[model samples]
Target: MSGTALQQVELVVRTIAQTAVDNEKYFGDLDAVVGDGDFGYSLARGFEKVLEGWDDIDRTDVGAFLKKIGMIVTSRIGGTSGPIWGTAFMKAGISAGPANELSGEQVVAMLRAATDGIKARGQSDVGDKTLLDALVPMTDAIERELASGADHAAVLAVAATTARTAAEATSELVARRGRASYTGERSRGSVDAGAMGVAVIVERISHAWTTEGAS
Candidate 1:
């Protein structure tokens, strides 16, 4: 937590890429339930590129690094996952601007910007039975915890819990966006793969924050 914002962002992005790579099959299996089954594949491939080119990534600032990642995800990844996730990093990068460090409120703002980009790119919202179902709630939880003056570690833990709970709850909701929506009421019994993926990724992020030295 004493390092520059660049260090924090690097840790998070690396954790996310590793998580996606590690859970490729699991994520694909989850997506196969109602989706075209490419969610995991697309995500893993994209993040893999991120890791593969880690040393080449821009390190001038957090914004530049994130924007570079956004470009890679959008161009390298396939399927809907590419554009949506790409837009998130792009928006977050723009929101972050040229900062070397970000406060808790600034972090929340960056997340909000990313989510907003996701909503626009995917044409979806919180109740759409998409990743937004988990992402929005997790962001909200972080905002609330920050308002209460929680530390970074505590905020991450709360965010992980909130994402998992929201993702699981999506099982009870009918899909309203993406390929899953075509399933109609039948999608109710299964959780949104994207949402659950978010939960899983967030959980890994939370764990890494505690044990990874965060530098």
Candidate 2:
């Protein structure tokens, strides 16, 4: 039997939490090169809170669950990442509404809404060496592949690859926003830590949904 929508969301959350925990040191090392090095700890702490409160999350409504995640992260995490990531999740949740299940189109819309929320919160655009560098491209890839009638696994594969590539490419660009921007040309040659984190999260979430959890 297929997984329920609540189960799918739980899988995604678990994947994200695990990814953050697994890559904590790596993300901190990345941030040390271009910005303050607290990103890893902050993200991990926030996701840890989400895990601790998982049982309390309202599973009947996917949107409510996602919004609860946003609030948990925002309240627990520190720095700009808290607000940015929180806003992204909140916006996606809003786009999801109260639906028990989401279609591919609804998923795409959620991604788009999340991307827009990030932009609005960060005031940054693509190629700015921020998370948007990876997220925007991933969203676009998902939209394109879904439009082409790709299956869930196929679309997620393409999206994950695109996000990874985009994150890697940030090493070639100068930072235009955030603490990294203060480094000017020195920010080049170092991948944006936030972008890499976003890539990891997206890839894991996609894998969880397409493989272990739901369509």
Candidate 3:
């Protein structure tokens, strides 16, 4: 891979951080309906810490950098959101496996690992109206696009769209996990905050990569 392509990992991190900052309040509002209303704040603080410690991370190794992100998030953010997001990043890092750069296939693998990690950590499934509602669909879309010989940018775009659609659909389902589950039928009309967060991150990632690739 070219040096330019390798730098895309850094771009992904920056994009996610910015997305978290921009949508923090939105996430909080979503959670306030069915959860503790701190989901957005926790995500924002965690990503901000990732940015703050960016200089200390081993940027040359994408896996190590992602692992650092997971560690930082776990340390900075309190509550269940911290461990869930941290586990996702850490599992993605493990899938990345010390690579300095990632291919389209590797990116898919990383996303799958992250989704699996969230499922394991939260003990939630796709119909549970958790982040997996968005993440699993996004990952599946990426895998399909890649299998069809789409490039990284194309795959990411499809995945982002899928995540958004899945997130929107969450409003129709009753929560089966997380604090939202405590609300039972009351949670049916509201979208999952974590799912919305996943949608935002994937959308930002798609936009960032597409813009960078074009440039």
Best by TM-score: 1
Looking at candidate 3, the ten consecutive residues that score lowest on lDDT are: 1-10
Question: What residue runs in model 2 are displaced by over 4 Å at the alpha carbon?
Answer: none
CA lDDT scores, all candidates in order:
0.92, 0.86, 0.85
Steric clashes per prediction = 0, 0, 0
Model 3 lDDT per residue over 41-146, tens place = 9888888888777777876678877887888877888799889889888899889977875777898899889988988899888899999999888888988998
Candidates sorted by lDDT, best first: 1, 2, 3
Model 2: lowest-lDDT 10 consecutive positions = 206-215
Per-residue accuracy of model 1 over 99-209 as CA lDDT, tens digit each: 998998899999999999999999999898999999999999999999999888899999999999999999999999999899899899889999999999999999888
TM-score of each: 0.98, 0.94, 0.93
Model 1 poorest ten-residue lDDT run: 206-215
Kindly list the per-residue Cα lDDT of model 2 for residues 83-148, writing each as its tens digit: 998988899888998989888799889888988998999998898899999999998999899899
**Global lDDT of model 3:** 0.85
lDDT for model 2 comes to 0.86
Q: What's the lDDT for candidate 1?
A: 0.92
Considering every candidate listed, which one attains the maximal lDDT?
1
